[model samples]
Target: MLTQHTSTCGKSTGTSTGARPGRPSCSLTQRHLQRGWFSRTPLHCPHRILSSSQAGCRLCSGKKRQYSASVRASSAAGAADLPAPRENLGDRIGAFRNAFWKFLRPHTIRGTILGSCAVTARVLLECSEYIDWGLAPRAALGVLALLCGNGYIVGINQIYDVDIDTINKPFLPVAAGELRPALAWVLVVGLAAGGLALTAANFGRTITLLYSLGLFLGTVYSVPPFRLKRFAVAAFLIIATVRGFLLNFGVFTAVRAALGAPFVWSPAIIFITCFVTVFATVIAITKDLPDMEGDLKYKIDTFATRLGTKNLARLGTALLVANYVGAVVTALRMPHAFRVPLMVGAHAVLALNIILETRRLESQQHSQLAIRQYYQAIWRLFYIEYCLLPFL
Candidate 1:
């Protein structure tokens, strides 16, 4: 019971996770007056954000949608005036066609693609004479689980960051008024349900239990009462450790089942899991650096808040470097036949990218955005996965 409860409220801090939205804190009255009702009145939300914890403001929702429609209409009118009606119609049709084909939902599409790739890779890797084709259902569940999990996280992000996101990332769908935050929450529930159903369609109790835990924890981390964003380090640990390590474990299990291979939880897997988890933490730290201000206002205790921005990035780079060293040491300890040159090459590329980025950081020249995304260009970890799959 304590384990389930402490997942949100820190064991040390016991900070309320659902007190408000975002950073979650004392109420308006509580902030000003500790006790005694002094003409108590409903606190009016100036931004009209109506945090998910509150009884939602229908008027605010309607006004926001109305304002959005007007802006869209005005923008359309301006474009229409510039172009001929026939041309504009043709352009609109083309844009819609492109969007539909590309599957314009960023998080949804990315989740689906990555999930599909990971599962497909696992299945192919386990095609040895010993493994069975029976593991298909399990592999498929992993895909659904990842997708559902992604949507829940994105939904939570949009719902809480409506104010900050509007300022920092206006392009975000909810903050930009392309979608209402409350409606987005509905979509989150629907997606999560669909994902769970898909995962459980033919799975056994073991797989079902795993998926349930993953879905529950991921969703809980996003919802209002928990709002794990306030505890960014905790959020990082969950995503980096549980999500990353368990994802690989699930994939490895499915692969072992399919290959009919011995399924011991090998040290190699442990090494890989630690490397992957640390790498994710590094990415999380980099992301939190630029988001420090938004996090600070909301009382989110991210790496940047705990450590300074430059220090956090530097620390992340150091961890990345350490990860490479550990990977090399682990690889050397492995049987020569299992030691793939491809793995070493992939690690080298990633390490070099980290090193260059770190040097740039030390020089104090690169912008925060560059630090956030530049390393993605290398994407060495994924390339390493491609090599590892062939070996598996």
Candidate 2:
């Protein structure tokens, strides 16, 4: 027989074949007790077998575990109920503004402003007798309209080129996830519409006509079925026509119309047209150098892809050198019109810099940087030449 009773304090005082007094006791052998088997009261201990001396131990242990689990669960629930930390208002505003600026592409914006100023100054300085002082505000409004149009042009390009830009210029707003496609499309459409409206309102019909044409060309350059960017010859012609030829031609014509002068191609206008066309050809061809990877992936037949890289670089460098030489010759020919010494010296230095940068493009990584730097330097030269145009 197994033990079925114990003293009141759970001390083993005797062994008996019958149940204990006042409470039920299980008669179990050492093996059955170790295996957690209870004959009379299975409810007393399901997980843990207990001797007659330790009747209610399982219940007490289960209660402690339940209490611990409840405490942890409540603590977790309380933490989840707390509010999250808030972002600063100023930081949020600043981030949004930065993103919007990147979407505009500040370099091109600067180019538009400089180009407009050059045209205005040329008319104001060279043909002031034709300008009505009362219509000066109209001219300023026309510049603003042109800027909006320029933004639309570039914005659309970014929208279409976002995939390529992710590979070539990942920091751009559209490529970097800072701007959404819908937002980019909205920005371009709004700018285009606003530009057309403003041009029609303040500027004359001539100015409005030219602005509309430029906007159309920009649309054709990036939009599907007519994206001229796919073919090297077409891309070259488009960029050269728009940026080099039309930009100067349209601006000069518009400014002359604003000044109440008949549109006439002055010697100065002809000179700029020819020079910019050649310079723009260099820009058109060389721009593809750093963008080779993206262009190749997208099957864009640029000058860099069609002609070898070394040949493209050499061609671009030679053209840049020629441009500088032409600039020096022009300055010398029209000393009465330009700051001759400054123009000559600046062009010479820019030419030398182009030569050095092109020569440095031997390694792939270095070539990318050198080509991009040269491209940017060319823009800087463009800006400086525009800044000097009023004097001419």
Candidate 3:
């Protein structure tokens, strides 16, 4: 028989009334009571026959404590591994700068810079007798105005072509959602306004008028109700007229006016105008090569889609090769004083390089990456021509 009695610690104790030899009664200790070791049942008391239950409870409690500690450690480690909650101001500013640079279309910007500098240099060379140091500031301002115009043109295109770009150029800032459309519109509008204002205030009426016309064409090229880019012939004409004819002729006239010299259709300027016009046509066609998928999906009806990438590639290559060859022949025929070995040699080399690149592109099956590389190589050739124009 067993009887329960209250211990000094206010816990129950089990005593064996029919005590057996060598058997001890189950007693509650102050420590056990304080630890709540006897709170479960008398069978869990350490001195009872079911003492193993107490040991099992202790083991379970120890395991739970270890598991809790491990969970806390893991939580702390996970928090340490996480990225910072917010980017710093400098990081944000740097990212925006990169995106804005892309938004400006670096390739076109390069062409503008080289074309402006080349025109100014060529004008100075042709009219060295009328060279004035004051024209330097005007030339710098001209470049700035052209850059603004370039930005506006490209930015507006990006804004309107977001869906097309998302498919064709997912990396573009506007297409990728890095830049908001409203912000893009504000930037383009500001650029257009600033460019026109700068040209009108500082340059002659000729330059201002030319600048306005270029802006107008650029606007109609991409903006709704006049998106001329939808038509192959219109797009080609616009690109050539704006980039090749207007840019070169307008810059030449501006520089000549700044030098107090009357504008003349110099052999060099005429040759460059014709050469670049053809080159711009090539650019207009080839630029759509890699974008055929998106252009087709959107019914943009570009040359690359209508004629196919292979056909367009061959056409662009043939046009560029012919332009280079014509440049070489033209350079050879110039007056002794106008002839330069650099012009002839450079064009010859560029023609060969372009031919080889086109062949390689065909060999590669005209992959998107190869097509882009070919296009970039053509731009490099464009830049080279500007660099060598002074020699001509």
Candidate 4:
């Protein structure tokens, strides 16, 4: 006969049929089984014969089902908490933009824009009454044309200097393999044509001719058969003529012509041209200092290669200081033309910076860094000159 156990789990629960006298109490066993304590055990009824392994009591079976369901729910929740992976559109666009800007050489672009703006501002100031407000868009287009031409010149320079640049400026587009030569040529040609066309359509013969001449010189400076860059003197003259004389004078003249005004040689224009010419000469000569290795390897006769780095540095430093000094003197003498105090103070600050930078260049560890920074500083001064031109 089986013992009928009145347990807490349920009434009329059967006791273990094969239980020994010293086994756990029936009530305790029922409570443990109901709580899923025997969940890991094989499917069988604890109260039935031990041989009947297929027989599972309802309470234990329900608990086993509940445990499996909880485990599946937990796994599903964990998966839901984990975020899915995806690409960021903004990051990709930013990367592409940075690469394109670098390829364009941001420093040169900045100089081109600032210089064009300066000339345009000076022209407008000088011939304010003559300028038609309707021609504002045309003026904007002219500036864009100038920028394209400047880009073309720089692009061609990089294309031809790829080999030398690999050693001297490996980060440049061509040398770094970021821009293909064929594509670069297309850009150059397109920019050159667009620039000439825009100038001819909007401005007149004076602007167009000057732009064509500048482009011709730039081509001669870089292209084969008449690669002026191979000759230090030719390169220096070409750079100085285009940047210092042609750019300032031609751009101003062109703007004035667009306003139907006669070209006038103002004191400000003369002073600026002189300053830019000297500045460009200094830049042209000193630029070779950092590229000495590649220049020597390629038999390029740069100022630094011919004159030596130390001599070139000293000469450039002196010339730079002199440029600022001259500017200060010009400002003081032509008080009616320029803000005397502002111009004098600006020049004095630039001269002092060169003095400080020269001292830092003496330190061997910091020489390379200081020299590069000083080169950029010269460009900053050039940009600042244009920014202040409106005041003058």
Candidate 5:
């Protein structure tokens, strides 16, 4: 008889049958394509719910079927051991996802479209209130440049730091051998091409400038003696300043051009851009903190390495507070509008996080978590604020 296996997915009795009638087999062997999620070092299932099927795992609840690998092995050992009918399809789908994910993995690509694009959702939404600010299509293209370019730059940088990341980020795609350099390069090229193509597709002339800038920064950030990372101060300026400006430039140009109108920067527009820049700078600094050790060892003179963690944290906190105060000041000075109060409330949360976390991390050991929180706080704050844009 073929045995049935039971697993948990919020308790409905998880059963997968691979055996014939009568008798019991403990095993239900199936091909699993999710090596990273399901079969990592110790292997961890991310969601308690039925998340992605890529990392399929066996269940052992023991009701109609008991967990018995031995019995199933004996029964099905001589069996074909071939890929299940659906497994092949799942693998292909997963490969497709992985390719896209690797190309634009700004937010890790498990959910949402991508990080760069998502970040601008709120900004674009707000800008839309004031101006025609393009729509999702062109905004998406700019985000593509940011996401894919970052991927290219990071991937190429990883090729250089394989040994460094091997020890520091053991599970990093490159470190763990999940992504190879050759394959990564192909993705990088494709994504960059896609970004440029999307620009040419609609936003033509304006896109030419922005795309070139994004791509140039991507190439120079990690390559050559100009390996901009070696110069921490300059690196900080490049990423933070450039990214913040590009976000505004992209939406402003696309929206204005589409509407066939000249762009006007109102107090409201300047406020949002400044807000984005300050917060982006703060988060960028926080990211720099975690790489302190690697930066110091590798001669990377980041803010944390040069200014020291204590000072860097203070700087980050200062920037966060400045962002909050700026928001408040702008809201008060601006004409009466619901967007002002909402933006203030959203940024208030981010400010609180900065005030709390920055004071606590006295040293670099806490960098990993601190850095992650930086991103989470940024996004949560963004979503809250951005959601208000459409209402206004």
Candidate 6:
């Protein structure tokens, strides 16, 4: 007879005749064997053969190892499915700032700034013997109001011409998808409202009325039902009126009001108004030169399309030359006290520059790049004219 031993697992370690004595066995061991959980060398419970505590520790350690591996695999899969981190606030803000700057059309903004400052300075010089430093704040406020109006005009034009811009100015914010149309519309409306409020609150009636008229012209120039930009003559007149006549006259009136001086149409104002009106017409014409493809595709009639690029370029150059000549003759006629030499020299030099630029464009066969460069040069001359306005 063989002695039988009972393990903590509650199975007898007894065998029948011809079986190995003390070989551990249990129902749990049999299940492990069927599932191939144990080694193939023997039919025995490895856990049962050990002391109870030691067997429990080994089994627990095995389960812990298996659980840890499963957990690690699950974690890796989840991590792989996770979304990428978001852009930080600073980066998002910087992108929007850049886009907004582009949306404002920096060149046009610079022109507005220079024109406002020049008009304000000229008015101050005319009204007072010494510069009134106190009026600087008011002048700046007027500039801001004008800038808001300018932004509204350009912003609305961009909104309406998004499709046209995709072909002509693909880098524009709205056309490039850098700005949403709804957001752009909101900005434009806010700008218009802000400009009106600023003008109405801070300026006299003449300034307010002129500002209102400018805003109206700007609205009709680009907005539907009166998109005068589609008509060559109307577009030219509108641009010349708002950017050339209205801008200078309004700023001059505002500054004169600030100085408590009665508004007078000085020779300086008249000269600048006429000069810039012609210049603005040139701008309106050349602005469409590089955009001819888009303008034609969309049936937006412009001077550049009516007169071919080369012909229009000649026309702009001829007009600019005539303008400079007129300035030179006018400067000569002015009394010696009016800085005649500076005016004559500046106009003469500008006339020469325009002639040279035109020749270069012609030599380049009026290619798109040449046309764009010419347009940019025209704007540069425009800036220089504003700088000279105060002296006049």
Using TM-score as the measure, the top candidate is 3
List pairs with backbone clashes in candidate 3.
none
> In model 4, what lDDT does residue 81 have?
52
Per-residue lDDT of 221-303 in model 3, one digit per residue for the tens?
99999999999999999999999999999998888888889878888888889999999999998899889999999999799
Model 2 per-residue lDDT tens digits across residues 30-52: 44433433433342433366543
Ordered list by lDDT, greatest first = 3, 6, 4, 2, 1, 5
- Per-residue lDDT of model 4, residues 1-392, tens digit only: 01122232233324444334443432323334344433434433345422223333434343444444443444455555557776599976775566557767788788778887887888788888897999889878988888888888888899999999999999887788867788778888898999889988987787788999999999999999899999999999998998899888987787787788976788888888899899899888887777888999999999888887667877888998999999999988888988898889988998898777666666554366666876777788778888888776
My TM-score estimates for the predictions, one after another, are 0.65, 0.74, 0.80, 0.74, 0.65, 0.78
Q: lDDT of each structure?
A: 0.57, 0.73, 0.81, 0.76, 0.56, 0.81
Off by over 4 Å in 5: 1-103, 108-147, 336-340, 359-371, 382-392
lDDT of 1 at 68: 35
Which tens-of-lDDT digit does each residue in 280-306 have in candidate 6? Answer: 999988899999999999999999989
Q: What is the lDDT of residue 3 in candidate 1?
A: 24
CA lDDT, candidate 5, residue 358? 59
Deviation of model 5 at 349, angstroms: 4.2
Model 5 clashes, total count: 4
RMSD of 4: 13.4
Query: What global local distance difference test value does model 4 have?
Result: 0.76
TM-score of 1: 0.65
- Poorest 10 consecutive residues of model 2 by lDDT? 1-10
Query: Of 1 and 6, which scores higher on TM-score?
Result: 6
- The candidate with the higher lDDT, 1 or 5, is 1
